[model samples]
Target: MARTATAAAAPRAPGFLRAALLLLLLVAACRQAAEENVVTELRCQCLETMKGIHPRYIQSVKVTSPGPHCDRTEVIATLKNGQKVCLNPESPLVKKILDKLLNNEKWN
Candidate 1:
């Protein structure tokens, strides 16, 4: 009787664990999607608040241009703390840092 009871519970244990893990993964995916949307909205409004790179916080950058002119370019930076900022892609300082990132240079 005892052996039969343990065997029945063993099969259900694995299934229960799998269901719990899947639910956790689903929750994480939803959280990330919502955070990305927030980042996009904040980045769009960066022109008013962001003046330059928070050097210590910068994680990566993306460049976009409204026209052929460099002056029209926008550099969107995703910071280490998950904040995003938009700055002039034409700036020499920004260009240097961007070049380092793009070139895959080793950190000093």
Candidate 2:
């Protein structure tokens, strides 16, 4: 009777410890995932921008207004060849194209 009681108590202690360790690991993983998601959302999409891309080469334009991630307006142009380029918002040609697109509501 004494041997069986000691064996049962020993197994119960280790089982409880294993369950606690597993719970701690799960909580840590969830915390890491949440932090990574927030970091991704905080980063800007455009890293480099071009000054003078011709309107004829552009297939479409997407203008993103400044917010939490970036402070300035972003203009992304998709070329006819399907390559995307970031356009300088302050450029004269870019401004003209933006005006045309806005007037026609052609920007995505």
Candidate 3:
């Protein structure tokens, strides 16, 4: 009976070791994901932006302010052709569009 008990305990030692190692790996993976989240910019939607796009080609505009995912403001425009493009916030054309959009005035 004692020998049988020892054999059962020996099998459990390897099983316990495997479970502990798996838990350790899971923890490390979680830590890596948390670190990636902390860096930000990974989730920023805009990859390329443009300037000097005429407002007449734009059907609508959406503005996103700086947040945890991005450090700079983003201006996205939906063109009349149903395509989206990122606009440069520093561009004079974009500023004028923003003014027209915010003030709800007809674009001149």
Most accurate candidate by lDDT: 3
lDDT of 1 by residue, 23-104 (tens): 9999999999989865543223335424567466787778765543333557788989897777766677677777888898
For model 2, the superposed segments whose C-alpha errors exceed 4 Å read 1-41, 105-108
Model 3 C-alpha lDDT per residue in residues 1-108, reported as the tens digit of each score: 999999889989989999999999999999998998766455567888998488789899988888877888999899999999999899998898999889999866
56: Cα error in model 1, Å: 3.7
All-Cα superposition RMSD per candidate? 11.1, 5.0, 5.3
Ranking of predictions according to lDDT = 3, 2, 1
Residue-pair clashes per candidate: 0, 0, 0
lDDT of 3 at 49: 90
The estimated TM-scores of all candidates read 0.45, 0.60, 0.59
What are the lDDT scores of the predictions, listed in order?
Answer: 0.72, 0.86, 0.87
Per-residue CA lDDT of candidate 2, range 15-53, in tens? 999999999999999999989965645646789999968
Which residue pairs in candidate 3 have backbone atoms (N, alpha carbon, C) closer than 3 angstroms, thus clashing?
A: none
